[model samples]
Target: MQNNKRRLVRHELNASIDVWDAQSDEHLGRLANIHAQGLMLLSDAPLVEERLYSLRLTLPQSLVGAGELTLAVDCLWVKSSEDESRHWAGCHIIDISDQGLAVVELLISRLR
Candidate 1:
């Protein structure tokens, strides 16, 4: 049997947010779901596995008070969906600033 070992509750989300590589400032993809620990990202191409990426997730004005949230994330896995038109990547967040953490908490509360 498999164990459900998620530490944080993951909220299913459909909100669209632009994602960028924090170091190079390159646009990576769109964010699909968010949790306190990590996020699921959807992209046109697969990201390199086990790579650490500094990400900037631009939150919607309606959702997160019109600002971008900065985070350092470790890519955990990548897989192609059934449609094969896009790729999904799971990432573990390594760091978030104080203000960003506050915003994320508020967002999580609202989402819950």
Candidate 2:
């Protein structure tokens, strides 16, 4: 079953990310967004659909450092936005730690 609760708690933040394309092993674009799921990368770049990836995403300033958590991710799907300017990849993160969960909780608190 899908996590239907969907937790409307979403945040927008500018962060740094390092993504290596699994298929070609090349570094892709770097960008950021406010997302509890990590970061909503902005790019029209194509990802290996349904493939798993390792992502290093910088936490928001509230976390207070350049440190980042490694996320094991699987791209659920990828679609271009209405403007056809960029693609937003819907992803699911795997195996998050308690500390990472705590940090996300802090971010949500700020949102409220």
Instruction: Give candidates' CA RMSD values in order.
Output: 2.2, 4.9
Tell me the number of clashing residue pairs for each predicted model: 0, 3
Model 2: lowest-lDDT 10 consecutive positions: 31-40
Give the CA lDDT, 0 to 100, for residue 22 in model 1: 85
lDDT of 1 by residue, 49-90 (tens): 999999988877877665788899999889888988899998
Worst 10-residue lDDT window, candidate 1: 103-112
TM-score of each: 0.84, 0.60
- Candidate that scores best on TM-score: 1
Backbone steric clashes in candidate 2, count: 3
Report the C-alpha lDDT of model 2 over 1-112, residue by residue, as the tens digit: 5464445544554344555454455665453443456444556676556878776554455554536655566777676778887777656666467776665556555533
